[model samples]
Target: MKSVVANYMISRKWLLLALVILLILLPFVLSDFRVNLLGRYLAFAILVIGLDLLWGYMGVLSLGHGIFFGLGAYIMGIHLKMEASSGGLPDFMMWSGMTELPWFWTVLQHPVIAILAGIIVPMIIAVILGFFTFRNRIQDVYFTILTQALVMVTVTLLISRQDVTGGTNGLTGFSTIFGFSLSDPATQRVIYYVTLGCLVIILLICSRLINSLFGKALIAIRDGENRLRFSGYDTSMFKVLVFTISAGIAGLAGMLFVMQVGIISPTQIGIIPSIEMILWVAIGGRGTLIGPVIGAILTNSAKTFFSESYPDIWLYFLGAVFVIVVIFLPGGLMSLGKKLKRRNSNEKGQTNSKADYSAS
Candidate 1:
C-alpha cells in the first residue's frame, strides 16, 4: 500500500481525500492565530492555481496578477471602510480633509454590490488587458513585461491617490462585515470556512477544465501556439479567455485574503508580490493543478516562519529557495516522489533481468 501510494498511482485519490479532511478539521484543532494564517495561505493557493492554468497550461506568464488581486481587495476593503465609518467618509479621507465620499465608493456602499464588484471588476480589467495584448498577437516575454508594467502603474496610482486609497498606509480598522463583528472568533472561523470552500471549489472547477476540450486547446497553445492556430482554432481568443479567467480567480482570492488580513495596501499589490506569486506556481510544478496549491502554501508557510525571525534577509531566503528548486527539482516538489519511484523501478527491473539470466 505504501509503495502503491508512493508510485503516484490512481489509488492516491484517497490520499487527497484524506488531506482535504485534515484541512477541514484544522480549525477545530488549531488556535485562531494559526487558523487565520492557514486561511491566508489557502487564499494564495487559489490564486496560484489560476496562474497555473495560464503559465502551466496556456504557455503565458503574467507578472501583473497582483493588480487584479489588489483590485478585488481594495474593492472589498473600501466597502468595509464605509461600513466601519457608518456612511460617512473613512478616517483617511477626513484626515486628507475631503468633504464627501468619492463617486466610486458611494456606489459600492451596498454589501451585495461590493461583493459582486469585487469579483467582477477584476474580470473586466482582465478582459481589457487580455483583449489588448492577446488580440494584438503580442506573445511571451513581452506580454509578461506588460503585466509587470501594469503592476508599476497600479501601485503608483494607489500611492498617489492618497485620499481615496489610503496611500501607503492602505485601508483597515474594520469593525464589522455585513453587520457581524469581525472581532468575534466565531465570525473569523466562518470567514476561514468560506475561504476553504472557495479554494476547494476553484480547484475542482480548474480540474474539470483541464480535462475538457478547452483545456486541451490551452495545452496545445502552450506546446505550440502556431501549430494549433494552423489547425483552425483561434489561438488568441483562447489565450484571452484563459487569461481573463485566471485574473478573475486571482481577484476572488484577493477578496478572501482581505477579509482575513484586514488590510490591503500598495505594498501587497506591488511588482514584488506578483513575482512571488509566479514563483509559487513555478516552484509547485506549474503543469499540474495540485502542485501550485502545495507550492503556495508551503512557500508562504516558510516565509512566515523565516520573516518573523529575520525580516531583512527573508527575501534572500526566498531567492535561495527558488534557485534550489530550479536546479535540483525542476518539476517542483511534487515531482520528487515520481522521480524516486522511477529510479527504484529502473533498479528493480535491472535486478529482475539479472535473476532471469542466472536462472537460464
Candidate 2:
C-alpha cells in the first residue's frame, strides 16, 4: 500500500510538471487570437474548479454560481466603466437619464477596492446563503433548486436596475485597465499572462486544500453526512465554509473573465451559463484537480468550433456530449488516463511475479 501510494504521488507530480510546461509554452506557440480565447477558457477553468470543489467533493450542487461570477465581473466592469466615463456618469447611466453615479458605484472608482470587493462580496453572499440553508439541512436537489432561484433573482435585480447595472445591455465599452490601453496587443498579452498566473495560483491553493484534513471532512460529508455528524462534527459549518470559499474562487475567475472578454452581460449570468459551468465539472472528472481545467478548455473549444461552423446545431452537439459523458464516462474523461496507468502497473507487477517464480 505504501509503495502504491508513493507511485501514485510520483505520477501526479509528473503530470503536474507536464501541465505547467504546456501552459508556459502555450502563449509562445498559439496565435494572439487563440491565446486570447485560451485566456477566456482559463477563466472558465477557474470557475469550474470552484464548482468541482463544492459539487464534486462536498456534494453541494449549486446552479447559481453565475450570480457570484457575474457579481465579480460587474465589480470590475463598474471600475472600467468609471475609467471610461472620465469622472462623469457612466454611458449607460447617462442614457438612462441618471444625473449622478449611484452610491455603490462611487466606491468602485478604486480598482483595488473593486477587485477585493469582487471576491469578498460573493464570499459573503455565499456564507449567508449557505449558513441558513445548511443549518436547515437542505441537501441534494432542494439545495440545487434554491441556487437556481438565486440566479433568477439576481438576473431580475440587475435588469430592473438598468441605471446602475447597465440593465440588460450589461457592462461594456471598457477602453483601458489601470491606464493601459486594452486595444494594445501588448496590454492584451499582459492581461493574458496575469490571468494564467492567477489560474496557477488558484490551482495550487486548491491542491493544498484538497490534500488537507478539511478536504477529508468534505469528502466524508459527501459520502456520509449523517455518519460524519454522528462522529461529532458540525457538518453544516463545514459545508458553509467550503461553499463560501468556492464562491470566492468563482469571483476571482469572473474578474479574470471580464478582463479577457471585455464584457459582462446579463445573458452570461443566466441559468443556461450556470448549468454549463456545472457541465464542465461533470465532463471533467470531479474530485480531480486537473480535470475541470481539461473539461473547460476542451468543452469550450468544441462549443466555439461548432457554434461557428454549425451554428444551428451547436446546442445539439453540446447536449450530445453531455449525455455521452454522463452515460458512458461517469467518472469523466480523466478516468481513461487513470485506467491506462493502472493497467500498465498491473502488467509490470505480473512480470515481476513471473520473474520471481522463475528464479525460484
Q: Mind sharing the TM-score for model 2?
A: 0.93
Per-residue lDDT over 311-332 for candidate 2, one digit per residue giving the tens place of the 0 to 100 score: 9898887789788877766667
Lowest summed lDDT window (length 10), candidate 1: 351-360
Q: Candidate 1: where are CA atoms >4 Å away?
A: 1-12, 348-360
lDDT of 1 by residue, 1-360 (tens): 466445553534555577578889999999999999999999999899889999888879999999999999999999999999999988999999899889999999999999889888988988898899989798678989999999999899899999899999999998899999988889889999998889888888988898899899998888778899999999988988888899989988998999899999999989999999988987888777888988898899989998898898998888898788766776776677666866797878843222110100
Summed over model 2, clashes come to 0
* Sequence-dependent TM-score of model 1: 0.93
The whole-model C-alpha lDDT of candidate 2 against the native structure comes to 0.86
TM-score on alpha carbons, each prediction: 0.93, 0.93
